[model samples]
Target: MTKQSSTDEQGDSQSGSARSWWLKGLALCGFLAAIGVGYYFFADQLSLKAIAEKESALQEYRQAHPVLVYVLAFGLYAMVTGLSLPGAVPLSLAYGWFFDLVPAIILVSFASTTGATIAFLVSRYLLRDIVKSKFGERLSTFEESLESEGPFYLFTLRLIPAVPFFVLNIVMGLTPIRVVTFWWVSQLGMLAGTIVYVYAGHTVPSITELAEQGASGILSRQLIIAFIVLGTFPLVVKYAMKRWKGTDARN
Candidate 1:
C-alpha cells in the first residue's frame, strides 16, 4: 500500500509539472511577442535621433507618466535579462543621463530583481523538474556542489557583470537553491551592478544639442569617480565588517 501511494504521488507530481510547463511555454511566447512589439513602438523614442529631436517632450512624458515609465523600465530590464542582450550596460549609463540618481537607482534595482526572479521562475517551471528526473543521478553532483555556497557564487557572478544575469538566473534555478533565498540574494547581489549602471545613466544627456549648446553640464571625471565610490559603499562596508571580525578573532 505504501509503495502504491508513492507511485500515485509521483504520478500526480509529474502531471502537475507538465501542466506548469505548458503554461510557461505560453507565457514565454507572449513575453517575446510583447518585447518585439514594444521595440517596434518605442524604437524611435529611445534612438539617438529622437534624443536629438525631442528631449523636453520625452522628459515631460516621463515626468507626467511616472508609472508608465517604470513599467517600460521593468520591461527593458526583463528583455535584457531574458535575451542576454549586449547593450544593457550602456543602457544603464543612459539611466543616469535621463533620471536623477535616486530614481535611476531605485528603478534599476527593482527592475533587475524582478526580471531575474522572472527568469528563475521561467527556468524552473519549464526545465528544472524535467531535467532533474531525466538525469537525476548525473546532475546530483552539480546540485550538491552549488547548494553549499550558491549565494556567494551568485554575488560574484553579479559583480563581474560579464555573466549574463538571465543566464545566471536560469542556471541557478536548475540547481537546488530555494526560491526565497534566490530572490533576496539576487536582490542584494545585483545591487552593485545596478548602482554602477544607474550612476552611468546619471551622466547621459537626453539631447545632444543641449550638450553641444552648453546647456547641460556633463559630470566632471572627479564627480563620476565620486559617484562610483558611493555606489560601492555597501560592498565596502561588508569588507570592513569582515576585516574587523578577523581582528577580533586574533585578539
Candidate 2:
C-alpha cells in the first residue's frame, strides 16, 4: 500500500509538471506572436534614418497630442526593452532628439530599467524551475557565486556595450540575484552608455551644421574623446577597487 501510494504521488507530480510546462509554452508563444506583430508595424520606423526623415511629422504629432505621444513613447520603449527587441539604441537616440537632456535621461533610465525587470521576471517564471530541476547540483556553486558577485558581474556587462542589454536581462533572470539589485546595478551600469548615445543623438543636427561650416573635424575629435572616457570609466573603477582590496589585505 505504501509503495502504491508513493507511485501515485509521483504520477500526480509528473502530471502537474506537464500541465505547467504546456501553460508556460503557450504563454511564450503568445509573447513571440506579439513581438512579431510589433516588429512588423514598427521596425522600419525605428531606424535612425527613418526617424530623421519623420522628425518633422513626429514633432507635429507631439504638439497635437502631447500627452498621448508621451504615453505611447514610454509604453513602446518599455515594451521594446522588455521584449528584448533590437531597436533600443535607436529608441534611446530618439529620446535625445525629441526631449531635453535631463528629461530624456530620466525617462530612458526608468523605462529601460523597468523593462529589464519585466524581462527578468518573465525569464525567471518561465525557465527557472526547469533549469533548476535539470541541473540542480551543477548549478549550486554557480548560484552561490552569483549571490556573492552578481551585481559586480552585471555592472561590468552593463558597462560594456558589446553585451546586449536584453541578453543580460534574460541571462541574469536565470540566476539567484535579487530583482532590486539587478535594477539598481543595471541603471548605474548603463547610465554612461546611455548618456553617450543620447548625447550623440542630440548632437546629430549639430554635426550636420558643423560639417556645413567645415568644422566637423573638431566636433569629431571631441566626441571621440568623450566616448573614450565613458568606455574606460568602468575599467578604471574596477582597477581601483581591486587595488584597494589588495592594500587592505596587506595591512
Candidate 3:
C-alpha cells in the first residue's frame, strides 16, 4: 500500500496549496475593499479647505488635549500614506501650520517612513510573488542591481520627485531589498523635500493673511520654484557624480 499512501500524500499537498492560494486571494480582495471604503468616506474630508478648517479645530483642541491630538494626527498621516492616498502633502503642510518646525519635521518624517514601510510590506504580500513569477527573466537585472545597490537606488528615487512617493513604496516592495534599508534610506532621502514643504507651510499664512497681503500669488510662485529646485537636486547630484567619476578615470 506504499504506492496508495504516496498518492494520498500528493493529493493532500495539492489540496493545501489550493487552500493557501484561495486564502491569499481572499485577503487581497478584503484589502481592496477596505481601500475603496476608506477613499469614498474620507476623500472629501481630506481636501485642502477641509484640512485647513480641521487644523483650526485641532489647534484649539491641542490646548487641552495635546497628546491626543498628536496621536490622532500621527495615525491619520500614517493611514493616508500607507493607503497611497493624496493628502500627504496637505497633511504635512497642516502639521507645519499646527506645530513647531522641529516637531513637525520629526513627526512627518517618521510617520511617512512608517506608512511607506507598511505599503511596501502590503505590496510584497499581495503582488510580489505574481510579479516575480511573470517577469522573472526581465526582472533579473533589477533584482541583481537591487541586491548590490538597493539603498542608493531607493535613496535616489526618494530624493527625486519624478515618481510619486506612494508609487515608489509599492514598486520597491516588488524588489528584493531589505525592509530596514528601505526605511532608513527613504527617511533620509525624503528629509529635504519634507523640510521644504513644512517650512513653506509654517511660513505661509492662512487665507485671511493672504487676503490682507495681496501678494499671496507671488509668494506662492516663489515657493513652487523652491520646491522644483529641491526636487531636482538629486538629478544634479547624480550628474555631478558621474562627471566626477569620468574625470577621475581620465586622470
Candidate 4:
C-alpha cells in the first residue's frame, strides 16, 4: 500500500479502537459508581423494626408533605433500583397501597426499567470484554442464541423466583441486546411482578399491617405463591403460543 493510503487506513483503525476504549471506560466508571453507592446505602442494613418505623411514619409524612414526598420517593426508588438494592419491591407495594396499582405499577415500572438499563449499560461498557475473554467459547453458542431468543431468555430469568434480580440486571448488560431494547423489554417483563406487589399493597388493610406483614413472615407464604404463579405465567404463555401455532399449521 502507498504511504498516504496506509496512513489513512491506520488513522481510521485508531479512531475506531479509541471509540471502543472510550465506551469501555465509561461503562467501568458507571459500574463502579453503582457498586459504591450500593455499599453506601445498604452498608448498615436496617432492621425490621426500622422498616416498621418507617412504614408507620410514611402515612403521616405523606399527608403532611405530599409534593415533596412524591418527588423524593420516586427519585429514591430510582436510585435504589439503579444501585441494585433490595428494598425496592416493598416500596413498590407501598405505592400501590398508598395511591393505587395503576399509578404504582406505572411509576415503578418506568423507574425499574430505567435503572435496569443503567445497570445494563454499565455491564456492556465495563465488563463485556472481560466476560467475553474468559467465557468466549462457552458464551459463543449462547451469544448466537441471544441474537434470536435473548429477550424471552432474559424475560424467563426475570420471572423466575430466587434469582437475584440485580445480578441478572448487570449480567444482561454484557449481552448483545441494545439498551433501548433492554429498557422496553425489562419494563414489560417486570410489570407483572410490579402489579402483583402493588396489588398486594392494596390488600394491606392498614399501614401497620403492611409493616407487620413484611417481618412477621405473614407475607412470605403469599409472596412465595405469587412468585410461583408469576414465574409460571410466561411458560404457560409460551406453550399456548406454540400450541396455537401448531394447530394453525395443521389446519
Colliding pairs, model 2: none
Question: Candidate 3: which stretches are off by over 4 Å?
Answer: 129-149, 207-229, 243-251
Ranking by lDDT: 3, 2, 4, 1
Q: Residues 55-165, candidate 2: write the lDDT tens digits.
A: 778888989998888788888889989887778887887787687788788788888888999888887887566556765664565467667665776787788766567
Model 3 residue 57 CA deviation in Å: 2.2
Report lDDT (Cα) of residue 242, candidate 2: 86
The list of candidate 1 runs beyond 4 A from truth reads: 1-28, 31-54, 82-86, 127-145, 205-251
Better of 2 and 4 by lDDT: 2
Residues 5-31 of candidate 4: C-alpha lDDT, one tens digit per residue: 999999999999999889878767866
Single out the weakest 10-residue window by summed lDDT for candidate 1: 209-218
TM-score of each: 0.64, 0.81, 0.82, 0.74
Instruction: Give, for candidate 2, the lowest lDDT window spanning 10 residues.
Output: 206-215
Top candidate on lDDT is 3
Error of 1 at 74 (Å): 3.4
Model 4 lDDT, residue 144, Cα: 66
> In model 2, how many backbone clashes occur?
0
RMSD of each: 5.9, 4.5, 3.8, 3.8
Backbone clashes in model 1, listed as residue pairs: 93-201, 95-201, 96-201, 96-202, 97-201, 97-204
Candidate 2 CA-lDDT value: 0.77
lDDT of 3 by residue, 196-247 (tens): 7777778866623432443353257668888788878888887887799889
